[model samples]
Target chain A: MHILLVEDDLQLGSAIQRALERLAYTVTWLRDGQSAIAGLADGSADLVLLDLGLPRRDGLEVLREARRQKVATPVIVMTARDSVEARVSGLDAGADDYLVKPFHLDELAARIRSVTRRHHGVAANRLEVGTISMDLATAEVSYRGERLELTRREFALLQALMERAGHIVRREALENSIYGLDTVVGRGALEVLMHSLRRKLGADAVQTVRGFGYMMPREPA
Target chain B: MHILLVEDDLQLGSAIQRALERLAYTVTWLRDGQSAIAGLADGSADLVLLDLGLPRRDGLEVLREARRQKVATPVIVMTARDSVEARVSGLDAGADDYLVKPFHLDELAARIRSVTRRHHGVAANRLEVGTISMDLATAEVSYRGERLELTRREFALLQALMERAGHIVRREALENSIYGLDTVVGRGALEVLMHSLRRKLGADAVQTVRGFGYMMPREPA
Candidate 1:
């Protein structure tokens, strides 16, 4: 998942950025609302973490403008204003979800997953294909009743495929989720990850859509 | 499909824009290389139709900058420069396809489809699922041996679904392809289109993947 984080506080922004990165999310941290708006307009990020109290332009205004422009990238409002009125206003302004300041990183991550899942119309964090099951919250994959170990990138790759199992997930989309947009990734990085993931899961667990991308078979053979 | 058209000539730009819109493509037209570069950086376009001769910055420079920034959006260069060397240089600069100006609009449209198909790793313009086949080049869909007529948006929606049969295509992705990113589409437009398509094809032709999107079964059920 790629997150465009609009937080002006240097310490908080850096900390959130690091935490999301650790959680395998590609984070693009911008300090103000203008840049966030521009980023959203250009479709640079898959999701947004907007802090309402922003410099140059208020984050709520940014969200409003994004919606006005019909930019459908989901936005999650993060602010110190914890009142129900504030939350309702943010939601009304087109924010998909809200996060109050002084929040735990774990809670923030959960909200991020929840909002993205809801946006994708997925009802839960657990994605399953046949005997293979994955818990998005814990980043755990289990095959038939046995737990399988996966590296961070491998888990991310699997999640991307499993999220839309039986569909060809584009190579670019997978790379964006695993390595971010600005990173110069090697051409074979995904292939390597897929090879490892397949070995651990099952030989027929993943299918290459040749030239397009990869897919997790809807019904494992 | 969304195309970022980078051309400086006002008459030519408008003509191409109108033609593409007529062909059901959502086009974002820019008149300079700098704006084109910014647009590409923000992932605003699905593909680029670029002119070599540009203002402020050379079109080649824009192409180079986009590649340097790790922007992998496919670009098709459209220019009056027809020399072998110029084509070679443009291809080296990461252009996916090339077209010389004073060309027929039909040929341009064909090349657009060809290039986008090649980029997606689709070897041909025809997509097939069981007895149903769609000729993207001619916009003709046939069920078994019977020909079926469809509206433009319906054709586009069916094409998107059939392109990756058996995979769940996200509703957002489908909407982006049908209505473009900036258009305010009605909520049930997709559902209505899918309903019409299913009626023509078969009740089991398309599967609703709940909130995520829709899919075409890998095998006819």
Candidate 2:
């Protein structure tokens, strides 16, 4: 998951970024609300962890402006105020969830899951797309109710596509999803993974845009 | 899943809310950071959809405040602006994933799933508690990885218990999880389902928590 963390304290931001990254999440950190607003405008973050105290523009102003412009992403408000009025006011103003200062990261993670689950509905452990389903725990995929055996590389490739299915995934993004930011894969590996997936899931399951990337088409109605 | 959506534009907010509900997600829409923060403080919403723009509180200030107080619920920022600087800034401030506006709701759904997966580390589609693994899709229970057939109601009851293995699940929560809010179930039904689950899984699979609900023990490590 890609996350935008808006925190001004360098130490706190770095710590949270590192922790989230260690859990395999891609994190982008900003030090102020102006940048946070700018980032919200740009569009790529799956979620926002908004800090109220920010330089340049206040976090609340950024949120207000974002909503005025019809940005519909979810935001969790974080602050030092533990008063009931503050909480009530924050929720009233469009913050999704409110957390007082000095809470546990694990609890934070739990809240994140809860909010995401609420947003997506049915927060299950597996991802089901059409006839294909991927189990995050086992990293296994089953197509048409039958398990389709996949190699490590092939599975990783499919997983990336499945994660971002329906969108016209950029070639570079696909490569990065499977090979990581620092690693370079050999030529034809993506093609090979696609070939294997097609052979297993029937040729029409995945669509290649050529020069762009791939998209796992949704099942016909 | 309980979601708090903080978008100010009434038309867009209502539209997105309807769309999300159509996808079966339970959502509460707020117009500003103050309300958003209040919802989170109450611990009602599981995840938040935050807009960077608002009337009073901006998205970044909300996030900064929430973070300062240590609210850990996940936030996804959505906006119409597109800029690398905005992306960097939002990430720096504490947004999970930034998504630009004018995006397909389907893509937003996938992004929600992606963020949830990253935040929660993926829950098992089939939960294994003690010797039983409950398959949520098929509503089948497996003992020692061997399939154990069960009736629909029995399967539902077992699914609820296994979801929060190692923790006591209140009777009301279990009832709501299995039976809809409008539906009424008999006390005997719960007992019968428990009997069937125990018969299939094991005698010790579920333990009755007096006056509260039931507890499903975790698998021995």
Candidate 3:
């Protein structure tokens, strides 16, 4: 899923970005609250990882402004403020989950899964479109109940497509969600990645829309 | 629903636009194929009413290019080209429904409804969200099974909001989908219309997101 990570700490942000990328998520890391507010208003990212302490503007102010502007993107607040009052304030400001700073990455991952599940109104970190089923928590994919092996890049690409299963995902959107904000990718990188994915899944698994992007059928071809 | 109408004939285009507006549909009327391709790619309109013969680019070419780009917006071809080969080619070029020229307006409206129903995979022209129900054909709206009386403007506005019941409909989107392309609306026009709707349905029927537009709950408030 596309995550807009708003954190000022370079070391913490870098660690979180790598951890999320390892988990097959594309990260757009911004270090200030002003930019976070603008990014959230764009309504492209599926989720937001917001830091309560931010530069230029306060994180709570950003959250309040976003909510007031009708941004329904789920947010998980990550901050050094571990006090009960801080937690309560974050929740009141419309945070989906609160993570105290210096926490384990594993806990952050769990929180991400739980938040996503709640958003999808599903019981677990599973997405089933037609014969394809994905266990996002474990990064496991199965076709018609048969286990399928996929490379990390392929898995990340498939996860993005699976999220919007039957709809057309524009090429730019795919690139933004699969690669980090600063990563420089070749022109043919996406097509090459798609080619390998199609070979493993099936030639008809992903349909290319010439100049636009790709679509995963509501039912398998 | 929003319809992108592409017809070069001034009389015909104006007639279709008026008919659609009378039915409470927001219409964006274009006069050529070049613009139609751009409109379809933008993906704003829910449906397109296309004419096959055009200047700059043929309607068939527009349809073919849009489909190639994965613009899955439903299109109903309204054209004088009624030969067997023409019909076959139109269907092959991704026209969802075809209508011969000089047809009745009622037929066009029916075609539009059928295309939308097919896209949504619904059996009838009805939308039910929570305790609210709307019959698009009859323009009838009810809350908790009781019929609610509404002005024409209010009904049109509510229809736009009901279409996206669970999500925040941006103010610009709502306006574009409810008013004709050339409409000049006052700043307070939407708010005034929304005020009456809220009064009839209940104070909490629609939630205002302050700076943003509005959201209707997935279920009754």
Best by TM-score: 1
Clash totals for all models, in order? 2, 120, 0
Order the numbered candidates by DockQ, best leading: 1, 2, 3
Q: If both were scored by TM-score, which would come out higher, candidate 2 or candidate 3?
A: 3
Tens digits of per-residue lDDT for model 3 on B65-95? Answer: 9989989787888779657567556755667
Candidate 1's clash total is 2
* Total backbone clashes of candidate 2, pairs 3 or more residues apart or in separate chains: 120
The segments of candidate 3 whose C-alpha lies over 4 angstroms from its true place after superposition are A144-146, A180-187, B1-221
Off by over 4 Å in 2: A121-125, A130-132, A135-160, A163-206, A217-221, B1-221
CA lDDT, every model vs. true structure = 0.80, 0.70, 0.81
Second chain TM-score for model 3:
0.57
**Which ten-residue region of model 1 chain B has the weakest summed lDDT?**
B114-123
What TM-score, over all chains together, does every model reach?
0.57, 0.41, 0.50
lDDT at residue A165 of model 1 (Cα atoms): 81
Chain A superposition TM-score per model = 0.89, 0.69, 0.90
Interface RMSD of each: 13.5, 14.7, 20.8
Ranking by TM-score: 1, 3, 2
Docking class of 3: incorrect
- Superior candidate under DockQ, 1 versus 3: 1
Model 3 chain A: worst 10 consecutive residues (lDDT sum): A34-43
